[model samples]
Target: MTTTGATKKVLVLFSGGQDSTTCLALALDRYDEVETIGFDYKQRHAVELGQREILRQALTRDFPAWRGRLGFDHLVRIEALAEMSQSAMTHDIEITLNEQGLPNTFVPGRNLLFLTFAAALAYRRGLTYIVAGMCETDYSGYPDCRDDAIKAMQIALNLGMEARFVMETPLMRLDKAATWRLAETLGGQKLVELIVEATHTCYLGDRRVRHDWGYGCGACPACELRAKGWREFKASPSA
Candidate 1:
């Protein structure tokens, strides 16, 4: 919590993606002084930029209470990562929509790197809360997105920074379907659907199919997972 007695100054690790967009909404609802942090991180394309900008505009335009809490940043370039091999994101390799599951689109150390940056930013701001959108149930099986990985990262951040930093993963236990439901409750069904339309999550870089759940190549693991979740969510009562 902050010393201002306004609860804590929470920083969200936002990416302008579907999950992160929802997390941003959740943070605004739960925190008194919520500040979102979206990074460039040298993604597959400018999709991150597009999504971040849309969310930034949407938050200030739609949510009057959170008008000034939206913050964004860009990383001009990333070094020493090109030779690290392709993961469908930075390469031409076929993104697995495979039946065996687990896709190669999993970028190495992605969550860990993002969380580390988020922790550093929160620590500098004297805040203890960092929000992230990670779910084990409906994901590409990125091992770092799990609860155990987050717990371990929390410990490391505490030890490294000498400050008790709490990484908040509200979507950790919920599947993609449940995520949509939460977004609807936090904001509204229409607003959540707006998020899906604006955010980006295409590993194959397909910006054509703009659904109410983010962009999709309609074939990769990410698109498949998101599409399937939405189908199930639309059918479920809680949706």
Candidate 2:
């Protein structure tokens, strides 16, 4: 069957972060029905889990156009990932580059397992598309977030589940600045404000110190990238 929004519903891997919120908005704009799925992997940034509900409420109140198209939201708790991972994301250890040259924040198989669980959920929910915000651009070198990895996961999910589910990565090629631009394009400044105010991206889960981009610790890699992106986004003529 042809993959089109008119005929297909979507399940978004929403973590209540800027990138995922943008992907959710894209899914809402493109699909007839849009559902959201979030993982409670017991990461250090657990604050984002609560922001999911806040974002949902804000979306319902601010963006009436998408409120009706929004479907059930699913929060899956996978503690096993935390149990197996000693990464900075899963623990309170310092965030730094490892001997392999990759950041210690890299939780192995995170995106892979996320796609697997999302595909399984989609199979049960009759969703044909799985939208995620896994971006290689403006990110801390996560191998699982690469386009090739996502495509391979799509193939593996289809073959393993005997189902055809399209994996949509709207921000796959866009940097963080471009991501912000896309959010403005989709819902204008309202969406951008919603993301900046409501979404959470700080790995340390710090919400006290608010930056122009959003609430983050400002020292971790996540906050640094977000801050840099927000500055660039604002400086751009299109923004």
Best by lDDT: 2
TM-score of each: 0.88, 0.97
lDDT of each: 0.74, 0.91
lDDT of 2 by residue, 1-239 (tens): 13443566899999999999998888877777889999999999999999998888887778878878888999999999999998999999999999899999999989999999999999999998899998888799999999999999999999999999999888888999999999999999999999999999999999998777889889999999888989999999998
Q: List the residue pairs that clash in candidate 1.
A: 196-212, 196-213, 196-214
Per residue, candidate 1 scores C-alpha lDDT tens digits across 1-239 of 22356565788877777788888887776676666676554557457666786677887788787676655443323433434746666767765643446566677777787788788778777778988888887787888889999999999999998998878888988888888788888787766767677877776667977665567777777777788878878898876
- Give the Å error, residue 115, model 2: 0.4
* Candidate 1 residue 64 C-alpha distance from true site, Å: 2.5
Clashes of 1: 3
